[model samples]
Target: MSIEANLEKIERLTSKVWRSYSKEDPLGHLSFNEYDYLKAIQAARVPIRLTDLAKELEVTKPSATNMVKRLERKGLVLRVSCSEDARSKRVMLTEKARAPLESESEIYTIIAQKLKVHLSEQEFDALNTLLTKALR
Candidate 1:
């Protein structure tokens, strides 16, 4: 296949896999962007400030605020007033977000297992390396 065709195929296959995995799960309601924001908040050492989250996600502060609002409405996150800076709010994951976060990791593990079963160890390692490089 041509490069463009191969890229398109990859996108389709990934979407198919994700859809299949998420179809019965509540996490399916979340967009990839929404999941990313939650994942970032979960990875933080403490409840993260909005400005810091924007920096970590490499998005504008306003963009991060908008996404936080969406996640808040979905009951996945909360914006608590920062203790040190009362004017600034910190993003935190709500109890509701726990299952989706765990489910996301499970989806990745399933994908990795499927790939490892189909490819030789070297091919799998090379694919992982190439994908990491390509993403960067």
Candidate 2:
């Protein structure tokens, strides 16, 4: 298979694995986009303003607001009045959000471990560097 085909297959397989894990794990139902938002919110380690969240994700404010609304509906996040700016609201992860994010992290670590076990250290490092550069 071509490199692109292999990459696409890897993505699909990884997502399929995540879907299976989600089925067995009670908190794994979140969509990839939802997970992205949740991870970003969690990374802040404190309530984050919608604007800042949007900037962090490199998305528009409206896009961030819409995702937050969806997350709130899912009971994964909460929008509270910003103490420093009453006009703006900060988004915080709900208690319900924690388990799934942790599960996602575990899934990633498992996949990485599998890859590391298969590849030599130099090969894995090169792949990591290439992947990071490709993203940039």
Top of the candidates by TM-score? 2
Worst 10-residue stretch by lDDT in candidate 2?
A: 20-29
Cα error, residue 89 of model 1, in Å, equals 2.1
Which residues of candidate 2, in runs, are more than 4 Å off? none
Candidate 2 lDDT over 1-136, as tens digits, reads 7999978977886887677666677555668788799989999999999999999999999999999999999899999999898899999988888776666777777667767897999999999999999998
Give the TM-scores of the predictions, in the order they appear.
0.75, 0.77
Model 2's TM-score against the true structure: 0.77
**Clashing residue pairs, backbone N/CA/C < 3 A, model 1:** none
Task: Write one digit per residue (lDDT tens) for candidate 1, span 46-123.
Answer: 799999999999999999999999999989999999999989999999988976676677778776786689799999
lDDT of each: 0.87, 0.87
After superposing all C-alphas onto the true structure, candidate 1 shows an RMSD in angstroms of 2.7
